[model samples]
Target: MNTFQFPMKMVKRQVYDRIAVQDQISKTELLQEMDITSSSLNRILDELVREGWISESGQGQSTGGRRPTLYRIDPTHRYILGLEISRVYSVLGLYDLQMNTIASYRWFMDEHMTPERLVDYVEERIDWMLNDYQLTWSQIIGIGIGAVGPLDREKGIILNPVYFPANGWKNVAICQMLNERTGLMAVLENGANTALIGEHWAVRDENMQHMLFVNVGAGIRSAMMSGGQLVRGAVDREGSIGQMIIQTDGERLHDQGNYGALEAFASVQALEQQVRQRMKLGMDIWEAAEDLRPEQVHFDTLITGLNQGNIFLQELFARSAGYMGIGLANIIHILLPEKVILGGALINANPSYYEQAIAVARKKVGYDDSYQPIFSKGVLQERAVAVGAAVMILQQMEL
Candidate 1:
């Protein structure tokens, strides 16, 4: 193959990507974004149309005389892999360039699911998915992983995520391992950041300039977007947002642990602990379910109790939501974002919990007299991280 052939091919892909993101683009827009001469760009566009990678989609409004033809990518012509890895479970999905979910699979994490086992599962699933879709390796854009942090995103490592079920997860080069197995390029990012990106894509038309995404579950995952760009840190410590000290004399995780961090108070694990401790101290959660062991006090059960009008659970969850609100207020005070999106199965399971968190946050922010931020539930919910992982591929500079 000619060395120039690769660069030319990449340029064509770049052309297709521009069209893909915009849904439709005209010659003028292409000319403005790309440095190529008009003739070269026309040639590329014509070649793309001939190759069936892109198509002429109607026409744009007339500028001076005749209208310009618009171009769009053939959405089905390519596929991307989106993966979200967390302490509880992982999601893998096949996505079109248009962000459609062609296929998806999920599995819960356990003590036995080490890095090697995870790769084994992913390799096998990708093989099956490709065969089922009747697609080949060459048609794939690449794999994107949205996972727990702190991560070494540049080096493609999962670093040290807290509360991981299995051992041997530290310093795992999962991106390289997946790339070696599937022979596709891979990009890794903090799950929270990916979820925020996914939310960005979901509301791209709105062009939200400032927003916060917080997933309140086993852990508190968070990411911020400001001025139409994600607020990234020098280190990909997404969970660090959870580690912010909320209580000066709160829970101590370890000797050096944060004294009442947001996660310490707002997370599902904390809720579960509180419930079990209360139950042990003669607080009856349910009359019939007296056998509810320490391990059995899950978010679902708590939500179920709330639905049944359990006052004890109502007060307990409300307190948790209040803490969550404090976390939101702290971030909102600094970023003063236009929107705050709350997600995670536990938070979404109860409408009252969502309301209370928003209420507490707004009350503390005290923006009612001035500029108040909007608060809403996460648009993508649990799938945000996984779908956002795929979106990250679209944003990959190399691609």
Candidate 2:
């Protein structure tokens, strides 16, 4: 791991990861679960303790012989920086080894912001946060960015992101640029993947090996975790659930020429367009959205109108929820995940949409009593992407 340059075998790393997740474990438990000799386990544990990654907590009651010494992960030994970039706003957080946010900041993202300007903004914020928290550069393990995609992860570049307001963003080497600017290791990942990672770690559900995370915003996307590992298909496009075809003769077609795609119906951009069209047809949309111009219609404005008893917006949102239900049902039937987590501003603003979508999805799934995946809102909500990005660094560190 970049944070710790200790030479260790794969088995030792695996044992260390287990202890990190479990909080505290005994040598007896490690011996039984790790399938390694006592001498080897002791040597690994000793090396980790000497390296300040693990520490003795207390004694554990033995099943038969002498008491066993318990070990716990040292949470303050290192830190990580997580950054989440979105069209409307961006967030930065500093996290310790135990995944605690020591400091955080959020700022608006102007449509005219450039890549160089963003890097400069981030560098300034990082310095301020470090100073406020009394931390040094040596304490920071690395930086992780949860960015909007499509991305070239291996090359650390953001490749033609959709809905990005700034120009000249094509193939921007975000990670490499940040690494050079801050002199720290950096990694880049899509919003969906990072959000899933954050939720998985936050829940800490050891039994939930199979789960699905859906992000509904300006666009729709999803990520899947199966058998305790992320499912990244060829080209890392395995979970583009938004592109799933729901109808053959669907009128809505995406830029990729796909008809009846999920995003075309359920995304915030689509909702805004639909609202604008209704306004142009002499509909009294302005009665509910009195101050908003037809061209200035946004998802939040629609939600406000819905709250003001606007029937048109109510129906429009319901229809959007139904479309989301169909898409989610298709995902459940194929993946059979243990749970489906929904996130993003659209879902958060109108909770009724999530309820209606789940009701419709349950009906479509039929009477399959063997496995029923739980549907719920993301626990981390808006912070999921940034926190997940930081957790990715910890995972890479094998903590």
For candidate 2, the C-alpha RMSD (Å) to the true structure equals 3.2
Q: In candidate 2, list every pair of residues with a backbone clash.
A: none
What tens digits encode model 1's per-residue C-alpha lDDT throughout 350-371?
Answer: 8888999999988998756788
Q: Compute each candidate's TM-score over C-alphas.
A: 0.88, 0.90
- Stretches off by above 4 angstroms in model 2 are 1-7, 62-67, 247-249, 253-257
| Residue-wise C-alpha lDDT for candidate 2, range 252-370, written one tens digit per residue | 63355368888888878778878777778767774756656778887668788888877877898899899999999998999999888998767887878889988888888867777
After superposing candidate 1 on the true structure, give the runs of residues whose Cα lies further than 4 Å from its correct spot. 1-18, 25-37, 58-68, 253-256, 397-399
Q: State which candidate has the highest lDDT.
A: 1
Backbone clashes in candidate 2 total 0
